[model samples]
Target: MFPIVSKLPDVGTSIFSVMTQLAQECGAINLAQGFPDYDPPLALQEALARHATTPGHHQYAPMPGLPRLREAIAHKTARVYQVPAPDPATEITVTCGATEALYAALAAVVHPGDEVVVLEPAYDLYGPAIRLQGGIPVYVPLDSPTFRINWERVRAALTPRTRLLMINSPHNPSGAVLTTEDLESLAALVADTPILILSDEVYEHMVFDGVPHRSALQHPALRERTFVLSSFGKTYHATGWKVGYCIAPPALTAELRRVHQFLTFAVSTPTQHALADALETDPAHDQQLPAFYQPKRDLFRELLAASRFELLPVLGGYFQLARYSQISTTESDVAFAQRLTRESGVAVVPVSAFYHNGHDEGLIRFCFAKQEATLRAAADRLREL
Candidate 1:
């Protein structure tokens, strides 16, 4: 057998995969991964079905994306963010998902020996993707109490070798939304550095508490250098569709498309058409998501109030982080998660897994993207602990 690539040899099964498997075996309520059990809007589903039978949609879409979808995205961007509409031809490229778009953007920009700064605990994909491109990932930790970035630490991490910075807003596992001040700070830090910014805004529609989602595109200086990536899956509850788009300046978009064309060429044609329809006509669906999910969040919090776990503040996304220090003496987050799954019949992802050094502590992440009954059942079971 051929020897494996040494760069990624240390990477085994993902924590999500392993925890989900354990969750299945234990018949636990799986809150390990961030995917909804509920179906997407019936209108989107109907559109998909209609497109499947409608003539010409079955063929491969244009390399960038279907023109209608790109135009719809442009309109949506202008309507929601007040940004000028992107030229569908030169400034937009659709990929298999935001994952693919992220990968492509990284590959296109990062060179050998380049330093890419990523905030920790980051999404698992960022480090591996950087490593694969021969770029080093410099992780800056965001510990608790504030979960905000230390600007001084971020400045210290930058060097002449620094090429890009990957940031996620409405962040995963933490439910932290980047504030306007945070974006201004980021802009100040990267102003003279020639560093590219990849802003993952997949959960853009999920902000709560009247907080407006701050997009990199909304910042004038950041917009010039930023590649903004968003997923239709997260917005529309259609994770399996795997249709996502990226917007960038023409130059950056060109480079990303070079990698994207070879990666997936294009996403499924019919789904693109269906998403176009959703973006154009059913925009209200996503506009209401924050209100829709807030009740679930409140319900889950209410249910878990009596439990030993202390729920952290959730600002956005489907995730809620909780500290279990009172329930168990176990210091290891992974062990605590495993024990919870086996004994409490509720599966959660250990927050420590998001850190580079495997931070074993009392924190775990729960996905609240379940049906009300599911959330209630899981919360009830968790109360027994």
Candidate 2:
């Protein structure tokens, strides 16, 4: 019999999977996972079908990515951030999704026993991926009220063993966007350290209430050390397509590609071609994302106003966190989510699942990335609770 590695034994089934299964079994409205229950742009879909029939796009794309797609990403970054365009041939490598890009980046840079600093409540992938590469994940909790980083806590967590910092904004589950001042604070802390950064900006276009989305590439000092990861799947409402890219300085990109080539080698050819077309010809698709998502968020919030749950402040992303302390004395978030799914026919993810220490916060995360009627249906069901 083979022995199993014990680094990730504590991590078993994900909250998303368990809640989704319960939702299916109970015939409940699923608002647990972060994927949209809507289709992507029609034009992009048509382009993919058209490209599939074309003879030229049927073959494998280059190891880095299709040249045109890389160029389109470069143009988009330059236009939005006022940054220099990276060489498509050298600085961009497409991966299966932002998930794979994150894994590849960590694998390429982290040595065994190296400490990778993470911001929590973090996406579940970051900790496991770091551990799989034999690196330690050091978590610094974001303070409540604002859910912003506590700079003193962050500085205290840093040591000579720190090799990388993983950050996400506008953050998932919390809906907190990092401000320019926050970026400045990060830059100052790592200015003299040998640490690199992996910035997950998958929800880049979903900022609300006139708050601008800050890009890691926009900060001059952090640019060289940062590997900015983004997903076309999230931006285009096509999560199943699973196309994402990473941008970094050539020196850092070189290492990213070394790991990327072995881990999927290339993304889907037709999707890459179609995404290139979408990026070049349809800027309006991403430009209109906030308006597209804000109404659903507002409607969900409006519907929840009559319920016992108190809505937390939402700044970005398709998720909204709500405290359920008033509804029940049950302090366990996992138990609350399961009960809500079974009795109320509405499913949500426990917020405590995102934290490393697993502190029960009496909170749950509900995703609003669904159609108007879907959001309305989930809200209507929650009103009875």
Candidate 3:
């Protein structure tokens, strides 16, 4: 065998994939992965069906994106955030998904030995992606339970080598939404620094209890220096479509495109056309999302109310974290997750998996984006535990 050196030596298959496979094998209700157990909106599906057969639309999209789709994205951004619309021609880039957007942004900004400050427990990709670009990842733990950013700790983590700060609102595992005050603090912190921001707002429309998602683009000071990434898949319940976009200043867009052009080159063409049509045809689809998801979140929590698990508050996003210490004090998060899948017939992701070193905090995450029947069944199993 050839001697091959792996860039990500410590990395294995992602926990999402691992738990999902285990769920499949054990015949468990698979809630470990952060995807809905339903199809996209009927309008979106019909649009895709129409575009698929339309003549002359079967080729690669432009390097940036389909003009129509980019324009739709621009209009949506302005309408949702009440901020100036990004110039679709120069400031918005359609990517393969938010995954590609994150990687490309990191590749574009980080040089060897540059430090990227990341809030933990972050999405699993942040640390490894930074390292793959030869950038050092400086991890700062978020305040536990609430998963709120401690601005002072964030300020302390910065150094001359710091190049980027990665943040996710409606954070994964813990569904904590960042406040406007949080953005104001962020704007002030990076006011004089060369550091850029990567705001992952894929869950922008999923905030519950009247909490609005505060995008980085809304802050005038942060807007110029931030590369905001969002996913159409998350909003539309079409994760398999893998269509996401980035909004940045022209210069940053140019740099991100330098990497993005070679990364995926362009997203699927018919898909973009369909998305554009869907956006225009059903503009209120996103506006109705909180109403769509909040009931499911409440139902899941209510179902488990009598169980030993302590359910955490879900301010935004579809995931829910539960402290399982009362159920089993001896098992580590990983072991408990596996046992829960195998015996209780319910699969979950251990919160520790989000950390680089697998730091356990007695938490496991449940994806509440499933259908009513699915959520009910999972809850039934969970209640028995």
Best by lDDT: 3
Q: Give the clashing residue pairs of candidate 2, or none.
A: none
> Which lDDT tens digits does candidate 1 get at residues 214-255?
999899999999999999999998898888999999999999
**Candidate with better TM-score, 1 vs 3:** 3
Indicate whether candidate 1 or candidate 2 has the larger lDDT.
2
Question: Model 2, poorest ten-residue lDDT window?
Answer: 140-149
Candidate 3, residue 107: CA error in Å? 0.6
lDDT of each: 0.91, 0.92, 0.94
Regions of candidate 2 where Cα sits further than 4 Å from its true position = none
Task: Write one digit per residue (lDDT tens) for candidate 2, span 161-192.
Answer: 99999889999889999999999999999998
| Root-mean-square deviation of candidate 2 | 1.0
> What's the CA error at residue 9 for candidate 3, in Å?
0.6
Q: What is the model-wide C-alpha lDDT for candidate 3?
A: 0.94
Better of 2 and 3 by TM-score: 3
- Candidate 3 per-residue lDDT over residues 147-207, each given as its tens digit: 9999999999999999999989988879999998999999899988899999999999999
